[model samples]
Target chain A: MDNIVTHAPDFFSNSQAEATKAIARSLWNRVLTSVCVALSLLTLVPLVSIIYLVLKNGLPLLSWSVFTQLPPAAGMVGGGFGNAVIGTIVMVGIGLLMSGPLGILSAIYINEYAPASRLAQAVRIVAKLLTGIPSIICGVFAFAIVVSTTGRFSAFAGGVALAVLMLPTILLTSEQALMGVQSAFREASYGLGATKFQTIVRIVLPDALPAIMTGIMLAVARAAGETAPLIFTALFSQFWAKSLSEPTASLSVLIYNFSTVPFPHQIQMAWTASLVLVAFVTLANITAQLVFSKKH
Target chain B: MTEDAARSSATQTPGRPDFLTVRNFDFFYGKKQALFDINMDIPEKRVTAFIGPSGCGKSTLLRNFNRMNELIEGVHYSGDIKLLGQSIYNKEVEVIALRRSIGMVFQKSNPFPKSIYENIVYGLRISGEKKKSVLDEAVERSLRGAALWDEVKDRLHESALGLSGGQMQRLCIARAIANRPKVLLMDEPCSALDPIATVKVEELIHELKQEFTIVIVTHNMQQATRCSDKTAFFYLGKLIEYAETQKIFSNPGQKQTEDYITGRFG
Candidate 1:
């Protein structure tokens, strides 16, 4: 007891020093937190500025004619990119039609049927590598396969390019979505005497449908904004495409073609076209988020 | 009832025939043996409970009855599991047909993310039953059999996920019996339920044995004694004891069985 009484003042003195250390530690914590907040806000600056600039420059020229009339010739005014909008939609639709089933089926095969096989592993690695390939290379590959064979730069060829680009995204996301379904669901279906195919189609596929739709929407958004592939394959027609075999005026190609011209009217149209493209992509992404959120 | 009368009642009848017979069963998962040479006879229309510690091959044996473990990669078993004297592993016996006649309920309640009506009819639907009247009748009968009809009868079209945990488990039980399989395999079906839900499921099990042979794998000793007619105690992937549930709980033949039941050690 006498020894403890003697050490009491020393313990109080040590605690005072420890309190100072704690204050320093808390000060460091607050500083680090502020730094993280500032860095995250900095990361958002480009996205915000891009939207702001597009709205500032494009909203003035945005009118009903933008979706109703064709684009004017260089140095001319009074027309809009109505054909380009349709072409974009048609080509993206074609891309989705080609990629959607193929991607989803392959994903199902990989995840549900042959998950541990060497072939599945190889396919997975190939899909991952495909995602990293430049979008321009996909354009070149499509040009070789479809453009050379068809002997023309056509909407079909552009669709082929976008399909190649969208395939990896759709495939990987669909696989992830299928994987997200609990194994318990499959076990229950199997336990109830459902065959492999029945279990997948009836139970697993239904559960994964929302996520697969989300992936498709995201792929659609990406395919819409892609400029390089459309440039090489579609090759920018001024008039509306007569058929899928003919060259088409997509929104991305129109913006690229018009932005380089010295004409002020076409430049303003480019800004408006940029706004339309941004809006389309944003709508697609928002729809994807909504679909995914609703599922959870 | 007195202990003697209860024991006599729980004991198998003299002429009762075996529904499932396991002969020299050995199981492996990628070079690691999960079960050694095992032998057992499960009688028809009786509830047999498999009690064991974790990883003691109780669940594995339960799953093998329906070939559920075959879904996993690198699982193989040597041993003839005979269902009514027909080898389940025979080349002529289709696994799908085998599974259809052997229904299983899992430890967790896994109701399909669908309507209660659809969930009960899933098995029949996959088997190509399309008549609406027949499906509706099956839904009612199975639900009543599982003791869930009164609670969910009015909301047959509602999603099964909206039900409480106990209700969902009963719904699963309802779903399992919808096919009217010869044998029902339960892998800790009541482990996820509360005390009230456990009692309800236990009572349901007692009622179900009148029509189906039930093989339940459980960790709870009291549940084994309360619900099962015959009990098989397992330890370290071996069958330590097999006898009437009353005899096993009251006077175990093996020290290991007594140790496990009395909570001395797993």
Candidate 2:
């Protein structure tokens, strides 16, 4: 075999430009990470501080009698939060009854089947704007519509008001979740000879169910915590609730009402009610996360 | 039986074209045509392979057999596609049954995020099979048919997501055949598998053709050579050459096929 030699450049040789660029990239990453850390800490510190203060002021008044007995009258020493806590639950549950199914169906219609029709686009725009409408405005809307129609403040009216605020939150979250499902999964189901409705019912919905449930849970939490909506719909009633047509109180509204009073005993009851509300909402949020986390 | 001479002699004695007949079929998606006027006779109980470059209408032609093109937003077709000697495009032809009889596997493996057993039984359940024993037997038979029985036999009750990529592909094959479709369409069945997994899938396809007519789309020429009886060569939506697999590979009569086989152009 004959051999020949030729001059060739060394392609593997290092360059100063590459090294300088690598150092600059490292410095840039450090700056970005520090900024993110600072921003997150800024958010986290206030949340932790609020929770601490709420617990410090409220835990001492959180007693068994507070949950088991009715609210005390003026000049009374002993009191409980039974009516307020039960009313809060009833209002939130009724609100979910109306809002959850309606919001989920609307989300499905928008994300799954609705082509870019004029009606669908208009509804979507309305939902987006509804996000900006204050809880107070929703309260007034429900007050005028549901409360006046019934001729009195009631738990059902509170539910209608809270659900109005909750609907946009649920619809938006569910649409985002449903849209997150891969198109490949949709095509695969369709390719398997499934009809459009069959694909939606059996395939698309199941895959998106976890995310949709998370959204509903967030809405549930929001509805549970709302006071302004409940205030206009459900006026404070120190006595027990008997009917949807009668006035009632929620934990948030009771907290607001009792905290404003000059009596020290009522103030303690308000703090206890606030603590209970936060704890209940926090527990509900945790349960939703556990239930909806996709194992795969 | 290797059965080579018997099949060749049977072809010589053929008196009628098989059930599925494509006569000068032209197909388009929107303004762009994806299949030219193609003439092909797909015999029952035989494996046909469609081989071509990317975007050559192999899968497009396969989907047209069952009018699945109707599922797409805008697709237009000309000429005829006959199933069992009746024009499939005829207004009265039931698309659901047509699709039920013709199963399709995609280029990528997709199994429902369900138990391995449930994945196979999904179609049967949809059609209202309630007897546990019948469904159990079907699950076993289908997994065995796809050659996935041994690897997943111990974990039949486990979630499908626990399976490896190759097993998932086989599970999809099992799912497709569980309904006892008369024809199976595979669009690049092994394009995503490793060489060993590819061999296993190719072998499974060979076994599958004993029970169903298989039309496979593959960019791999060697796969067509090994598994197919008839080979159809496509180029940019046109059917250039379709013949016995040996002739198509060893001695294609078309110049374009020659250029393609010789690697002059893709």
Q: Give the candidate number with the greatest DockQ.
A: 1
lDDT of 1 at A212: 90
Deviating ranges (above 4 Å) for candidate 1: A1-14, A288-296, B1-15
lDDT, model 2, position B205: 89
**DockQ, structure candidate 1:** 0.62
Best candidate according to TM-score:
1
**Model 1 docking tier (incorrect/acceptable/medium/high):** medium
Residue B109's lDDT in candidate 2: 87
Q: What lDDT does the true structure give each of the candidates?
A: 0.91, 0.84
What shift in Å separates residue A161 of candidate 2 from its native position after superposition? Answer: 1.2
True contacts kept of each: 0.77, 0.28
